[model samples]
Target: MLDNIEADFPEYAPRRPGAPKALDGIRVVDFSHFIAGPFATMILADMGAEVIKIEAPGPGDDLRRYPPVHPDLKHGAPFVWTNRNKRSVALDLKMPEGVAVARDLIATADVVVENFSTGVMERFGLDYEACRKIRPDIIYCSVSAYGREGAFADRLGFDPIAQVESGFVSMNGYADREGVRALSPVMDISTAMMACNAILGALVARERSGLGQAIEVSLFDSAVLMTGYATMQHLFSGANPQRHGNTSPDTCPSGVFRAQDCTFYINCGNDKIFQRLMAQVIDRADLAEAEIYATGPDRIRRRDELFAILGEAFARQPWSYWQARMRVAGVPCGQVRTVGEAIRSPEARERGIVTRIPHEKLGWIPNVTLPIRYSGTPIVDPVAAPAVGQHTESVLRELLGYDDSRLGRLASAGVFGADAARRPRQDAKV
Candidate 1:
């Protein structure tokens, strides 16, 4: 078995010289895959929780296979995006020994996160009920397409389905074409945020009550919220929302516009912003003074004429010129940049939104940190995402207090994987 984990995960740096992280003492056993559950646990990891990701001996999380793949890393960009600062423990859960080792980890974990299909955990004998028996105060979280019970619990779901079912897709796209699901996994992203908040709340409650509870966050439920007030308006007005394309149904002069050289977006949320845009940015003082465009309601009533005028004016200038004018005028506007441009923008680099971090084999790779800022409990400096089963020997020996003999026994039983056979046998517990 692998005795030295440093060879497996040279990028796995667990600690740095810092003040203190909010979750310094917390330990999380992450069984989540893809986006939501992993995302939630990644937030916790950012807060300094020790996240132990249990992956199967072979392929590991499916996200590791997503593109654009790194040639040397084996895992892809999507996997690295969320799985950073986590330690990977390879275990073949199909084997009884694997299940036993998983239970051992859960017994010591403060939080357990899973996004497997309903009843899969139960079948593995690692369900919340089974886990709670090992550690009664364990905060268990299950992320799913739907709730774990009821009529639709068995149904599998992805971000697109959630958007469709929750009315999110219906609210997007132009009214003429069929409604389109957002290219981004907005539902999944929102669900991750919800699950993160729920887990944090559970942790707070546990502090006072010394008790743990289970949390369930579903993509369908969060996707509805992602639709914003459309659901509420439907209840009140008893009418379904029609897709409005890039334009907002509630606000005028709030959509994409083309400049001489580039596309840009503008949002005149209220009459005041509209006035500023006309008077300062576009220098249309007469239009700013017009009674028909003085209020938000009036502007909405005449959005077509207003858009036509604005489009003509914007077309005369390049994006940079309009952006500078809008900045001075306090108009909410930005260039409609591609993903690569957005990440490499000067502002993003200055703010450390996207920066380079050292990797084991790759030397350096781009890293995107969480957006949150804290004055006291600062986030930990991130480490690169772990390789599958990279920390198996270390975690088994250090965290689980298993010695060389035990690890060897588990390895011999085909618990770890085919790769496990290559790891040198540990002489003794670390």
Candidate 2:
């Protein structure tokens, strides 16, 4: 797979001046795997940073083995999706030469990202203290299950664990059954976003103070934030938030309901929306003006009766009929859609959210462009994810200016395996 790893992306050329890129000369040493840290670095790479991903020898990042693997790619879809525009350097930190080389890379790096368990970086001599000694003003970010200083820092964690422990899972699903965890790793992904924001903030501060600092983002902390303002509400009311399934606990008529054909959701978040829904969509002006349902709180108090009345009206028509009526009534509503359906919807196409990009081997593959849009200095053209140690020799030759003989000695000692001896090609562009 490493031997056949390829790229055929269009060469990026700015169409206008002053588009040097947001992180034109920034260098990031990425020592992360799986979701969080790798994703954070990928965002930086998308902004034109040079990201060097240091992976363990052998199969490298575990995300490479995830299911739904890309037929023509070395890593699976998740890995490829998050790791594009980064260089892969297979290194065995267990070996002294590998550790020495990693330290050398960190010595000149402007930023470093790691998501290993607590103390793992320290064991490899790549911790914040060691990195600071090499480059005193280097931005270093650490991602973990819990933070580094907490009592639970030693305990391992993942997205699901964070979700359950942070009250996220408790607030989901129906009150009757067990709350289900989100199938996707929401906590890990959101934590990565937080980490990226922190890294950007650090970069901005470095420009002002000429000093870099350490940043810590964890799945646990981010998961709690994902719980929204439920914690604050609970503290004030001293009441636990009940699981509402598809409905909003604080809003009336905001739940899933089946039309004659398919299921749909209605969100009458305010009294005006509820009145519009009742008068225009359901043709029941009496309900809209009734004292029992005139206000949001009153509607919530009599939700059962209101839902029964709306359900009967909605059941008389198909989802499309109710959708159109709600749209004209100024009521927020949507048809329930599967993941695949949502991706292929007309709105998604109109917005260009889902697109097919040129792939070297497959010819074209679907890519999801991020929601972020910049009027200037747009994201760099993307490249396919790299194989294990795909850029190892090139990185050494270019960044450290190591000749073939030095690379051979390192490979001879199992610093990056015998594959490191492969000739570096000019086409190995991140």
Candidate 3:
């Protein structure tokens, strides 16, 4: 399925033969799964950190089984999107031998990230304190729903739950209907970005102080901040934000509108933009000069009347007609496009936002690159997400200097799970 899509789309391969990377010498031992944790580690990986992802022996990360699964890859699109530029090592953490190997790996890592429930890492003896014992200057990061400590530590939370609890869901959608949660996991994505930023900051601090610390990022806390300026507004006014749908409560002439052929949106942020919209785009100088439409507050007071006039005027022209004029007028406007349309739009193509990268089994698969640009240091080349335990043998051999004899012994002891124990010794080859 992915192969077909890549075949029709443009292929992208960044060319920078020997450029330095931002995080060239760093190594991260990633025990994170799902969106928040894995995504944070992926950002580090993109910046040239060697990220070693630890997963369970059989199923691996739960996100691997998410929808739109690839038959050959086994994992789904969500996992592929976040796990690039990383190696995967599957181990049975239930076994003492597996924990020993993890400790050995930790000793060689600069960063350790995990997002298991409050005490899961402590049970495996891989928590922040345990990791600090292995390597004193290790930067340990924990991503959780609430926090690793506190009364809500035991509570399980997801993106929708965080949105509802943090008032994010209360300030979206139309006022007439119940507020709706974002279809995208905004809370999870925002938390991941925050975790990445925190880790980067800790790395800088450690470079000067020669000390490591534990950092925590919570979904609820990030969601609350994701409410943007509304939180501050509520504090100042003591009034909660109301749902405004596509319209802006503070700005006049800022909402979805319909052109003759299709739907578009226009935002006249100030009086000048509104004047330009009237005199330049729609050619309504009478309305532009009228006292009722002179100021933002005045226009807002007669919003229904003004919008009705704009609506009738807009219905006379197609989206293309208004878009070109708006471009010249400097008015912020765009066609209300679907996900597919937006991805394939002319602007997206110009920005190279979506492209295809090579994959081992699939020949080539779709890849969405990070939106970062560096003059001296470039991000690492994209690599497809690894299959479960794909690098178990290689990681043990290279990082820990484990010999074939020791690997065989650990396998026999069920350190790599029963299925691995039953496989031929040569199958452990890197």
Candidate 3: regions farther than 4 A off: 425-430
State which candidate, 1 or 2, has the greater lDDT. Answer: 1
Stretches of candidate 2 off by over 4 Å are: 1-18, 421-427
Candidate 2 local lDDT, residue 236: 98
lDDT order of candidates, top first: 3, 1, 2
* Model 2 global lDDT (CA atoms, 0 to 1): 0.85
When 2 and 3 are scored with TM-score, the better candidate is 3
For model 2, which pairs clash? none
Candidate 1: worst 10 consecutive residues by lDDT?
A: 1-10
Q: List the residue pairs that clash in candidate 3.
A: none
Steric clash pairs (candidate 1):
1-423, 1-424, 2-423
Better of 1 and 2 by TM-score: 1
Distance from true location, Cα of 360 in model 3, Å: 1.3
Per-candidate count of clashing residue pairs (backbone under 3 Å): 3, 0, 0
Candidate 1 or 3, higher lDDT? 3
Per-model C-alpha RMSD: 4.8, 3.7, 1.6
**Candidate 3 C-alpha lDDT tens digits along 1-430:** 7636764568886858989999999999999999999999999999999999999998999999998999999999999999999998989898888999999999999999999999999999999888999999999999999999889999888999999999999999999999999999999999999999999999999999999999999999999999999999999999999999998888899998999899999998999999999999999888878888889888878888888988999999889999999999999999999988888899988877788887767889887788887788978888888888888888998899999899999888878767778994333321
TM-score for every candidate vs. truth? Answer: 0.93, 0.93, 0.97
